[model samples]
Target: MNITRFFIQGNEACARGAIKAGCKFFAGYPITPSTEVAEDAAIILPKEGGTFIQMEDEISALGAVIGAAWAGVKGMTATSGPGFSLMQEHIGYAAMTETPLVIVDVQRGSPSTAQPTMASQSDMMQARWGSHGDYEIIALVPSSVQECFDFTVEAFNLAEKYRVPVIVLSDEIIGHMREKINIPDKVEIIARKMPEEGPETFLPYKAEPDGVSPMPPFGAGYKIHVTGLTHDERGYPDASNPETHTKLVKRLCNKILNHRGELTRVKELYTEDADIIVVSYGAPSRSAITAVKNAREKGIKAGHIKLEIVWPFPEEIIRSAAQQASDIIVAEMNLGQMVYEVERVVKSDAEVSLLPKIGGQIHRPEEFLEMIYKCQK
Candidate 1:
C-alpha cells in the first residue's frame, strides 16, 4: 500500500485531490480563503503533467475550464464568494452545454464583499440556484480537511459520470483549517465514456439509456457542434422548437436527478432512535456531532446527520428522519438557507428549526446544547 499522509490545509488538499482524480487542466483566479487552492494547483499541476492558468477573472476562469473539458481533459477551478458570484453565468453555460467540470467554492460572509477572512455557509443556496434557468446540480459539502480532498476527487468522478459541473462547497473554516489526512496512491477514478461509433455516425447530444451521452474529445475526429442554445442530439441549435427545448432540458436535469439514489451520500450518528435530529453540513457538522453526543449523555435521544452531498437536496433521508424524530434542527453558518429545504421535505411531520450563526463564527457545542434544551422545552 503506497499511502502517504500529511498535515495540510483544506484548500491544499482540494488541489491535491484534483490531481489524483485525473484533473489535467486547471483555470482559476486567486481569491481570499480559496487562493491557496489555485496556488497549490499551479505548483503541483505542472509537475503532474497538468496545465494551470490564472485567468483575468472568475468568469474567464470557469470559461477556460469549460473549454478544457470539451478538449477532453478533466478540469477544475476554485474561488470564494465574490469570484463565485462572477462565475454564475459561466456556470449556467457549463450546465447548458453539459460540460464536465469541478468548482470549489470556499465560502465567506456575503451578499457583497462583507468578510474575506471570515467563515460562512451563506452560499449554500447560491450553489443550487445561483445561475438563471433550470438544471440539476451536484454539490458536496466537506466538514473536515480530509473530506476537502475526498470530496474534490468525488466531485470529479461525479462530474464525468453525469457530464455536468460539480461543486465542492467548503466554508472558510474548513478551507483554512489544518488537519492530518492520508492520501492513497490509488483512488478509484471514473473516466469519461467515449462514443464507440465513428464521427460519421456519432450524435454528440444523443443520450444512452443511462441519460448520459458519450463524449468525444475535440480533435477525436468527431465533428462536434457544441452550443448553449436549446440543442438537439446533434448538438446544434434548435431554439424555436418548444418540444426540442422541453425534451433537451428535461434530460439534462434528469441525468442527475433521476439518479438521486446514487448521488446521495450522508453520515448518520445515533439517528436510529433519535428524538432530536441535528441536520448540518460543512463546518457546522463538526459542532453538531459534538452537541449530539452531549445530548445523548443527558438522555436527550439526540442524533446528527452530516450531509456529504448537499445538492439534489437529499429529501429521502430527511423525510425518514422527520418520521423518526419530533424536532429537526438545522444548524448552518447562514441566516437561513438550507433550512427551507428541510422544512419543505419535513412538512408537518416534524417541527423544523434553524440555528443560524453568522458574522464569521462557528457554533460551539454548548450553543447546540442550549438549542437542544430549548427544543426539549
Candidate 2:
C-alpha cells in the first residue's frame, strides 16, 4: 500500500476516511470544530452514491445513523460539546442494540457548550462513561491530521468488527488543524461480517466464537427485534431471568475485553528507564511530548504515555509504566478525569498528581515541565 501525502485539515480527512471505509450514510447537525466533517460528507457522500442527511437536531442525527446502520449501511455522525450530550441516549441505544456505528466527537469546551470554537480534551471521561449503562466503549483520540484520518477508519472497523459503537474522540485543535497527511493509496480495511445462513436460521444476538454475534440488517429478511432493554439470544426483550441479563451483559463487554489485544491501541515515547512519566492524549499529547523532550535536554528523566485508545483504560500499559516510574503526572484539559484512572492504575507505589486546566486552553509545554521538575524535587 503506497501512502500519498497531502495537506489537509483533520475534519476533512475524517470525512474522506469514512468514505474510504465504506460509509454510505451520514446523519449529523452542524457544530463548531466538527462542522467541516458534516460539510465534507454532504459534498462527498452523495458523489460516492452514499446518503447524507442534515438532521434537525443532534439527537435525530444519531438516531438516523443508528437507523441507517440497522439497514446494513455503514453509518456515522459528527458533533461537538452540547451535541455530544444530546446523542448520549442514542449512543446507549446503540450499545444495547449492538448496532455498528461510528461517532466522531470533535470535542470542544464542555459542561454546557462552554466554548464552541476552542479546543478541549474535557470529553475524555464523558465519552467513556457518558451513556447511562454498563457497556464497553472503544474510543480513539487522534493527535494529528494523519491519525485523525487513520483512526476514523479504525473506529468504523472496530464498530462493525465488535457489533458496538466506536467513537473517534477528536478535539477542536486537531479537528481544525491543517497539516500534511499521508493517506495510503491502498489501505487495509475491514467490513462487518454478515450472516451466511438464511434469515430463518439467524439469531441476531446469538454469540459467535469471538463473542460478537453476526450482524443481520433490518431489511435482510431477518425478523430480529432490537431494543434498549436486556434481550435474549433471539433479540426479544428478556428481563425475566437474571441469568439471561447477566449473560447478555457479559457478552457485550467480553466482545471487546476478550479481544483486548485486537482493540487496545497506544503509542509510547521514552518510557524505558524514566523516573517521571507524563500521561496525556489527544491534542494535549503533542505538547506533552515536546515537554518530555525539553525535560530530557535539561537532564530530567522524563517520558510520556500518549494514548491512542482512551476507553477500556489501558490498565496494563499504565500499570507497567507506573511500576517503572517514580512519579506519574496526568495532564489533561479537564480538572481531574484521567488522573483518577492513573491513580487507580499506579495505586500507592508511585506519586500520581493532576495537572489539569480547563476552559478551552491547552496545557503548555512549560506547564508540564514545571510539574516534572516539582515531582522530581
Best by TM-score: 1
User: TM-score for every candidate vs. truth?
Assistant: 0.99, 0.97
lDDT value, residue 130 of candidate 1: 95
Per-residue lDDT tens digits for candidate 1, residues 207-279, read 9988999989899899798989998999999899999999999998999889999988999999999989999
Pairs clashing within candidate 1? none
In candidate 2, which residue ranges exceed 4 Å CA deviation? Answer: none
Clashes of each: 0, 0
The worst-scoring run of ten residues by lDDT in candidate 2 lies at: 184-193
What's the lDDT for all of these models? 0.94, 0.89
Instruction: Write one digit per residue (lDDT tens) for candidate 2, span 1-377.
Output: 78788898999999988988899999999989899999999999999999999999999999999999888899999999899999999888998888999999998887786789898887787788888978888999999999999999888888888888999999998999999988876556777787887888888888889888888777778878888888998889888889999999888888888887766677888899899999999888999999999999998989999989888778889899878999999988888988888898789878898888887888899999999999998
